[model samples]
Target chain A: MTETNKTWVLRSRPVGDIKDGDLELVESPLAPLADGEVRARTIYLSLDPTNRIWMSDVDAYLPPVGLGDTMRGGGIGVITESRFDGLQPGDVVNTGLAHWALYNTLPGASLAKLPTLPGVPLTAFTGPLGATGMTAYFGLMDIAKPKAGETVVVSAAAGAVGSMVGQIAKIQGCRVVGIAGSDAKCKWLVETAGLDAAINYKTEDVGAALDKHCPDGIDINFENVGGEIMDAVIARLNDFSRMPLCGLISTYNATDPVPGPYNFANLLMRRTLVKGFIVIDYFPRFPEGIQQMAMWLMEGKLKFETDIVQGFENAPASLSRLFEGKNLGKLVVQVSDEPK
Target chain B: MTETNKTWVLRSRPVGDIKDGDLELVESPLAPLADGEVRARTIYLSLDPTNRIWMSDVDAYLPPVGLGDTMRGGGIGVITESRFDGLQPGDVVNTGLAHWALYNTLPGASLAKLPTLPGVPLTAFTGPLGATGMTAYFGLMDIAKPKAGETVVVSAAAGAVGSMVGQIAKIQGCRVVGIAGSDAKCKWLVETAGLDAAINYKTEDVGAALDKHCPDGIDINFENVGGEIMDAVIARLNDFSRMPLCGLISTYNATDPVPGPYNFANLLMRRTLVKGFIVIDYFPRFPEGIQQMAMWLMEGKLKFETDIVQGFENAPASLSRLFEGKNLGKLVVQVSDEPK
Candidate 1:
């Protein structure tokens, strides 16, 4: 059989915003799966802000993608052929940090069989029940350690991890406020996600909005969108406030070196705790996070959105959805059809 | 029977670096002490970087000195007379957040009496045994939690808190690296404070020096001086590193808003814990910290430096010693004669 694999290959490191030709879609013939290997056709490809970090030749949490190598990403796929035990064709699996390709030939041991939860769709494996959900879970629960009645503020409140963060904080019995780019996103955060309040960062003065909302001052800052929004939050943090630094989406596409929050001195004055973390660090605890998040989902307490951009050819261009605030919640690409 | 007291009174809030008219040496007739009040003559006035912070009308750990009020400071003083039960004439006490005055009339109940340690000078109270000492102790012990083999990096390594931080880490059996302004201060940190290495930030490429000294990467950063030096340290932090941010002396005098470390994103990439703290927060546990630090001092495991500037008139001008990096260690102004 002459099956072909189409993959996004890193042609050059992105200078600032990812421009054309920095990555190229290259086609190659698929190789035969060896013993203990599995062939899975991509169903959903997770496009995140961190993807921009991976394409840069900088020291990030993970090594930058090597020039000419397959563009690294996270995705969910359905097994087409398997040579290892406990696996069969048509079984869905999570390709942990896999290639942005139509077909991924991975070691069967490395792929986790996606658990089937009632009423949960396959796209959720790329969102609330997957890496993004886990990111929001541990970042808030473990780092922020929210307590009842505490004021919790989350940036990028309309984005994947952020939406979950606000909902989780609300579940924890805290007064949650969200910061998002658009008024529509802000409305969704308060109306759908049940945040105490939501600020439209693009149209409103974030500092003034935060002041009006967080009268008692912010006890926890779930930092995602850094820069001015972060500075505004930092300035309003209460004494001994906790900040779980999940992502700096605002600085991901910058050409020059990004300076930290302008009100960084407030961190000292307020005696705040600022911690930076990646969700992958809590991989071992994913079962715990997913189980808890799943319970909330089943209870109708958690709501999530998946902004799916279809086609394998659109992977690179689709990443701008996150940077430009075009995506409502989780941004992903539908590379192939989900099993019927 | 008319004795007068001279005080450094806040005339106007300083915009950046404190100027001559921002504070004035105002002399007023001393008020007669009421019951439960003590009259103390200032022995040593601590001239610290935080003094500059208090001079600015910005929100800080404590309320900024109100215009026309006595400038807020920490000092050691000899009680001339006391009406409260425990404190009496000739007793030395710590005037907690008192005024920068020749004589302070304070409530006797609020004063902490100084214990006479054999061979320990009064100057030591301002250095390794006072607020600055407590700043280093808790910031390192409670926040950093240094391990035996860990590499600890401290900026402003020759200053009051920094010097003690390096020594405390040394006692913890960690490789301590110091970052200071001068070659002389660098020599003192390595030779006298027993630091493993010292980087002259002014004369050396701090990043290159850190690379050469800290082969294992920095596990704890006792951040006293924030700016370029902080960025250099942040870039090389080990995974799960802890940063106890005690001070940001480098930016205290900036006329414009000071931007944080350019490599701030590395804090996330490295999963670093950055906590801003003030020594006053650890007041309840001071006895525990002082006990351990005092034990090390008596065991010859800890050494300290006191950079004394003479006269009450020079108190305002002497604060420049900290900003200009002219002081070797603990900078204090000798306000009045020490009791014989």
Candidate 2:
């Protein structure tokens, strides 16, 4: 193995919009592992909206990433060297902190063994069947609590979590509406995902479109894109509506604060409930989400989609595709050939 | 008594703001009572923020007040004439859909006798010990659920529900911060209401001031005023903070849509929960709130103040004072007074 590995680090804090120059790829010799530490080679990398949040210095649910530090992300890897008990070489594991690198050494406690899912792709462990799937399953069934005969609307419908949320709502006997950026995504959501209705937000006025389709108004709104689309959803909420806020992909790369349509008074007047949550908060129920999602997939009740970009060198550009709404589904970067 | 009475009716919908001309005081003769109807006189009218919501044509939690109809409100009154078995003359009771008039007829089912609270002021049954106190008590305890040693903040701190909310947080062993409009109100909050800190929002920079006082960030925010103050509070929320949204007094009277500061990303980044509630939703627990509040009043653990404006003729002007931030406490209008 080569002594030096390439990793991406934050070069400077982004002022308004993030650019590729803001991140730098550097080569450095892998540090020798201390006791209870292991060296692992990256196999697959996950890109999410939260990475954009880590770039800002403002106080949030988590601390801001320091300048010159490795960009934080989740990855699937195989252990190449281990000094820890129980962990052995060639063991595949899932870890939360990973850089855009080929090889890295981290503490043993930071990694969890990747549980085997028979006949499912190993890369599914990094996508819809992993954190993203668990987020949608728990966030909809637990927080939103959509009842039978209720109208459930999800934004970014063709994306990873949104796709799962629409399926889960349907399984719970709800009339589901999906909002996506393109007509093709809308058609895929309706034809493949079995959504009750799909609105192409790019071509139609979302608020008026929702009014025509959901005359009864939305009972539960799974919010993923929190900008103008959220403003549209707010106008169509029924009394006692619940909104499970998952992500804000629309505003992740925003240089300046995007001015919202601002209808907070509507929330109060409609007696609505809006809550923000991360999938990690529901760690206690991860196994349950996985079990249900797996059963659904096995029974052909759930379908999975991935927008894979080949090659480790394409990782940076692939990640930025999510912010531009270019990805059709769960976005992933193939780091290297699957381990034999 | 006369068979007919004078009542104030909504003559026209206000274009941007309400004025005296929009309402007309008119007299109409009452028809003979049918089988289930009873005649009653207006005694104590309940003025609330919900009245403003009812006036707007937009879809709200409740139906809008229709044109040329008697304005909707709740009132405690005495039966003047009865055609039903359960009600009789001089029975003091609470009823909704009561017209703002000297006297009118309603169904016997619409009225409920005001429960006797011995040694407690009857006016208390109408103010803090009534809907306002119940809203504050349940909203804080049930929704916000602040833990001991955490900080809880309330807006409109000198007003009815806000005053009770701060004291209740303190009783639960949490530090409390109050935001009011005047220096005198701030003094009253600290010296009289026993809040840990009070900020006169009109004189202080609320965002910067809150940062100095609540360094750990707000854990529970009982929102009553919802404009700039809400934006300021939203910016300082800690992870998993809860906001029990009760009212938006700031935007209640706006003729044009007021652009907000757009801080919803703060909700997502902080993993905060914001829930809007109407007091009627907590009706099943009303007895519990009333019993505890009554005991607290007797034990001197809770104190209440009211700004009673004399004469039903001044009701409209007095109600307007709430939106203007002129009312110091629970604003009520006195109709006819009897010798004590």
The DockQ values of the predictions, listed in order, are 0.86, 0.66
In model 1, how large is the Cα lDDT of residue A89? 93
All-Cα superposition RMSD per candidate: 1.7, 1.9
Over 4 Å off in model 2, which ranges? B338-340
Q: Candidate 1, residue A61: CA error in Å?
A: 0.8
Q: What is model 2's C-alpha RMSD?
A: 1.9
Candidate 1 wrong stretches, greater than 4 Å:
none
For candidate 2, write residues B145-188 as lDDT tens digits: 87999999999998888999999899889989999999988988
Candidate 2 lDDT (Cα, 0 to 1) = 0.82
| Worst 10-residue lDDT window, candidate 1 chain A | A1-10
lDDT of 2 by residue, A172-254 (tens): 99999999989889998899999999999989999888998798989999999987788889888888899998998887777
Candidate 2 lDDT for residue B155: 97
lDDT of 1 at A300: 89
Q: Comparing only chain A of model 2 with the true chain A, what is the TM-score? A: 0.94
Candidate No. with top DockQ? 1
